[model samples]
Target: MVSSTAQPPATKRLAGRTALVTGGSRGIGRAIAERLGREGARVGVHFGGDATAAKDTATAIEAAGGTAFTVQARLGKAGDAEGLWSAFDAQADGLDILVNNAGVNGGQVRPAEVTPEAFDHLFAVNTKAPFFITQQGLSRLRDGGRIINVSSGLTRGGAAPDLLAYAMTKGAIDVFTMTLAKELGARAITVNAVAPGVVDTDMNADWLRASAEAQAGVSAASPLGRVGVPDDIAGVAAFLASEDSRWVTGQWIDATGGALF
Candidate 1:
């Protein structure tokens, strides 16, 4: 006897998984966090500051029928990675997915104008933080888990000269991704990088929306005739975090909507 009111079950690919997304309070990080939450992962939304934003992100996840918590820690400082993990430890016993998405653009400093201070800051947040974070997180991350790094399309050719320092940091991330994937292969932990091109996030809204010309220029850059949204990158991150990406490792996925091509 089939019931007339019977409903189809919801899909929760990440059910029972625990994930931590750095900078998850906003931008692409928030998108990834929300998507993972929808997939049924108990997500730890990490933020540097802006407790309010972090709370909002957590609320959004919970509102969507997912479990979420907030973790606050300022990265790029001494012992920052350890402190971040400590905060996460207080809430969750282990981690199944780690997304290193926190980073800074280091302004628009060209190679000639780049200073030692700016370079250090850029590398600290974009490179060193992720490296040490991963080092400390390995203890908490369970085997067969996932590690997804948010890289930039600027690391590829045709990048603007003004983005030299910023791109260098992401370049290091690419190397880190390949090397770490090899090292972690024994544990069945897949490591990959998701490279996005000119995503329309709050960070880029200032310039990207400055004028119709600006907007059109960006849209035209992609063969798809559109600018990328945070969800565009999130979808790729979600795939990398899921069991479906088990065989995909050590690859730098281009999420640029064919802009590079």
Candidate 2:
């Protein structure tokens, strides 16, 4: 149901748009931040760790003649999400795009083995934070603005037994995006999700380091020979943020390089 012809001029398409990308210090989030900045939008990079990485991302944006700032926040903590908005808003003023890209795989624990604390924390970051964060961003996001929730292809592709909890969280992301898009549709704010396959991010790189077998297994199982890269997801994210996808909403686009198929 996306109207591809609804595109606007590139120069003014996302100009003046301010975006907040959570867990944006590295990986897919970093790619999204850089891409949006290149498109003439003010960028807010949110990080849970590696302050240096966050600063580096912000610096890269500035170096490219774009405005940007960084904020550190732990989505696992209660009230931390509210604080994140305060800092992000102070830096960028208002938001036009919000990318919920901060997530984890529950540290390779199976759902049956996951403790209450572990499972709760995963949902807090992957599902809870985006829900409340987007709620907070509503006042700031302009009508016809964008929201891109980062999910995982594992929900449909089936996760390794150890990744069940992580897949569960991503499932919530899809439902959250669909329901919220309907709720916000009246205002023209388009809500959608992008589910990525195994991407060559710092996150996956760590997992690859921990278990090369697992990494090799994923690559071999994929329809594409290799894993995905950050730019792969970033390009799709940029389209969601731009006027090119103004009429798109309430759905999840799989950016898994056909891994699920």
Candidate 3:
């Protein structure tokens, strides 16, 4: 007779898959990397200059019964994309998921204050890097794989003018997502963007945690009545990376907790 004590099987939606997450050492990238690991994906936790943090993220993934490894390459520089992929290929034979989550904010500078150098740097890291990185990865990314880009709600408007250049970069990503989705559809690959509003991460801690009033102000803007956390966006990324989102290609998923409304 079969025993009645049989437990339910564990959930590992991404088992036998491999993923590479840029900037996976901290903030939203870390959260996405960890989540993907938890789902049974062997994660490449990529960092720019923070080896320790990348190691920590990989360690956390392993501690949670998942596989992870750290890779480093400072983005926005020449040869950065190739370097990142070389490091990735050394660990994994091919990739199934690619999360382009690394970027810079260009400080709160407005149009007049924006320098030529600042503009170029912003586009290099935020737009050009992802474009080249994806181009390079296409050969390594297997058929039916997923490419999820981290975008910004600022692209939808209502954000401060200070974020103009930054938003422009994300807007380009939006277009890239749609067009690339069409190009890769024959291969069954899916491309999409995840746009998040102001989130409570190290990136925003300086201002979001400046005062109770400041925190409250941001929370009030969202119907959810709280600032979004990295995990909130991570959940959406995980979904996009999973088989569940097979039919959801070329879309901009709003992970902003109704802030845009």
lDDT tens digits, residues 98-198, model 3? 99999999878888999999999999999999999999999999999999999999888555888888899999999999999999999999999999998
Overall lDDT per candidate, in order of appearance = 0.91, 0.83, 0.90
| Tens-place lDDT digits, model 2, residues 73-133 | 8887898778898887677667788999988776777667899999899888888988888
lDDT of 3 at 66: 92
Name the TM-score of candidate 1: 0.95
In angstroms, how far off is 169's CA in candidate 1?
0.1
Error of 2 at 135 (Å): 1.1
Let me know the TM-score candidate 3 reaches against the reference structure. 0.95
Give me the candidate number with maximum lDDT: 1
**Candidate 1: pairs in clash:** none
Cα deviation of 100, candidate 1, in Å: 0.4
TM-score of each: 0.95, 0.90, 0.95
Which residue segments of model 1 deviate by more than 4 Å?
1-10
RMSD of each: 5.9, 5.1, 6.1
RMSD of 2: 5.1
